[model samples]
Target: MLFLLSPAKSLDYETPVPAEVPATIPHFEAPRGPSTELIRLLREKSPQQIATLMHLSDNLSALNVARYKAWSGRSTPENARQAAFAFDGDVYGGLDARSFTPAQLDWAQAHVCILSGLYGVLRPLDLLQPYRLEMGTALANRHGKDLYAFWGSRIADHLNERLAADRTPVVVNLASQEYFRAVDRKALKARVVECVFEEWKTDRYKIVSFHAKRARGLLARWAVLHKAATPRALEKFDLEGYGFDAEASAPERLVFRRKT
Candidate 1:
């Protein structure tokens, strides 16, 4: 994962990739991970204080949440997934978490996965901003449930603007599905944002997104698991296109302009 710190080095991948902003995105590339002092400050502060800090200064931003937290090689994106799997298959979850319900996890995972939103584990740098700002604002307002809802809305807006600027398709997560579906969609002919996930057993779950009404015959049924799971190392996965696991749970739905 340390190698991912330099975006230039990461650009050599074979797949067509999203335009990145290395500085802003959180990855495995910080000077000291996180300091003990920072975690103490965060733990002591109220959510409102955290939110205010997020909006006012970069010093105590939400991105700092996982700075010092430790991750094993399985979750590190280092040590090549194959080796991690060979050594500790259960840790990295080669089959993806979709096989289990979010409710079934332990306190730590519930805090990290459900509450902390994986603390920028798999997300890219540029993509983190919209969600970060949205979460910060919502936390400040004390509208907790609305965090995801508001995040979805703001992300949808950001995606709309990015799409209009370029006709490029990129990888996104299930967390943003509700948001993307809320777009008014001004003039971007190519409206696809490939969603990457892990099915229960294994492999990336692929979701193809577009204006649901317009996608009609282009993708056959409204939803289906077109690409099955993959075996081998983590790098063996294909992350460059539209995909989703139809067999998994229902994605969060985003309602756009409502009609009577």
Candidate 2:
């Protein structure tokens, strides 16, 4: 089974990745790759244009502008870090890749894939440069009006290729709707199973964004630690007080709930 995740806006390049943790270039980071074209378009935009386009403050827009300007296709230790270690958001906080052993990271590299607006799909150890582009961004490209159009069926096709070698050939979707939309479901060949994490609200169970995001990472971490290769093994997830809700779960949708 392959695990799907979304990229985080928050990043952490300051934290030093262990020297033993090896890194690889992104699958689509070639000389004339899709990212190169997007960077070329982004380079044309001024800080003010970026501010308006991405709905950012003046400071954040300037920061991203600098990142774009300094961006290089080369993947060196100084310019880039592993994707899993670089992302420092809620989901990543739960993933805690910094604590993972090199062996565990190797396993995650094979099973986990992160969807990105700029770099299509990324494995755990894929080298990542600093940039801020959400999949929902309306930056028009050669493909169409939005990033979704830009990705089209490419993401799904790539996932299919990765899944072809798996015994079960299943995709566990832990991504948000925005990023997942980039994937053309019609083009994907694997069975997709979405995992929903909910917490008890005032009256009943509800999906709180923060808890849900963290839970997704927690699930991935649990899978990595346990080497869970089958969908059935995922049902055993009980991290952070969560329990599988058999009543709310279906074959395509697995629901996990927590009292807190």
Candidate 3:
């Protein structure tokens, strides 16, 4: 089984990561052309243009501008951090990768993939530079209009390749729609199962974005901790108040609901 997750915009590179887990280069660049092309394009844009494009504040835009300028695509332990450890959004908060043991990280490195705008697809231990280009961003590229077009079927093909090696060959999609859309569903050979987390509100069960994102992270963490090898193994996940709702679930969509 393979798990897909979205990269976080908020980063925590300042925090110290455990020294035991050595950082690895992202597969996008090595043995290939420079992956810094996106950064090159980004660098062409002025800070003001970037601010308008990404709808960021002056300070945030300037910060990212500096980041893009400093991005060398050549990542080292001293300059860059692992994708899992650097991400500090709600999802990463629940993932808490800093607490994961070396063995758990090893499992995650093989089983998990993080979808990104700049780096394309990343493994858990992949080294990453700090930047903020969301998958949903409308940055026009040579491929077409958006990042999705630039990525096209490449992400799907990579996932299919990874799935081909797996025994179960199933994709557990924990990523949001924006990120998942980057993957070409028709090209992928693996069965895709989406995990949904919902809360029982006053009237009905609804998906709260914040809670659902965190739940996705928690589920990923649980899967790594237990070394889930199949989609069926994931059905047993019951993290943070979430319980699998078989009645509400379908073959493609697994629903987990929390009463709170």
Candidate 4:
């Protein structure tokens, strides 16, 4: 089921975009690391001891014991696959058990969307891991189709940021090939237009970006385009038809025609 909201009353469907956000990212908290006590303890313990504690914490403190165990199986692969899965599970896929009545569970569907809003806060590949079945089941039951839509919209917003300015506004960085392939390129571009115009309903920003790239070389353009039905009129999402070969990269951004 698609989530629906009324378009802004003033949008002409010709020019729409969320108030542009500052190019600079706001400062965030310090990165994660062992606490002082944990660091001390690690110094005193061996690798086996450290792994034992970690395993115990994860194994014993989980929400659904049976489901978590089943998902993990008798043993872990202990290689690239295992590490990749572990990283993915850390944010978007993992156990978060809870007991609630049918109504409560239904509400959680939206609140705990995509295995607990992990997809929103985390990278896309983070969802492609071994998740606790109990938690995933809850999310799927609650959202139906809204979860996927919400997830798509989130990525689309990110794409807007990457494409909102000059063809080479900041940098061309892709943490992983998986990131670029995270979503359907064409559909994601379309969704970016929808999300930007939707947010524009309130915020008073002007210009925005719509990224696209295809093949080795293509036009990387960001013109003030038009949207449909939404409040703004100048919302554009047609990369290929405009002579720009579009290939979705990290967060599914559309790459531009390479420079000569």
Best by lDDT: 2
Every model's Cα RMSD, please? 16.2, 0.9, 1.3, 20.4
The lDDT, on a scale of 0 to 1, for candidate 1 is: 0.26
- The predicted structure with the larger lDDT, 1 or 3, is 3
lDDT per residue for candidate 1 within 1-260, as digits (tens), equals 00000011011113222222121223322434321222333455554575575564445444344332332212322211211111111212322222223232221121111112212232221211112222323332222333343233333443343335433432222223333333333432333333233222234322223222122111211111222111111222222222333444233211212111
What TM-score against the true fold does each predicted structure earn? 0.25, 0.98, 0.96, 0.22
**Residue 68 lDDT, candidate 4, scale 0-100:** 27
What is the lDDT, from 0 to 100, of the residue 153 in candidate 1?
Answer: 39
Q: Tens digit of lDDT per residue, candidate 4, span 131-174? A: 22111111221225333432444444544443365342222221
lDDT of 2 by residue, 1-260 (tens): 88999999999998888899999999888778888878888999999999999999999999999999998877778899999999999999878888888889999999999999999999989999999999999999888999999899999999999988877689999999999888899998889999999999989999999999999999999999999988888999999999999999999999999996
Shift of residue 203 alpha carbon in model 4, Å: 58
Candidate 3 lDDT (Cα, whole model)? 0.89
Using TM-score, give the best candidate's number. 2
Model 3 residue runs over 4 Å out of place are 31-34
lDDT of the candidates, in the order given: 0.26, 0.92, 0.89, 0.24
lDDT of 4 at 130: 30
| Residue pairs with backbone atoms closer than 3 Å in model 2 (clashes) | none
Tens-digit lDDT track of model 3 for 160-217:
8887876658999999999999999899889899999999999999999999999999
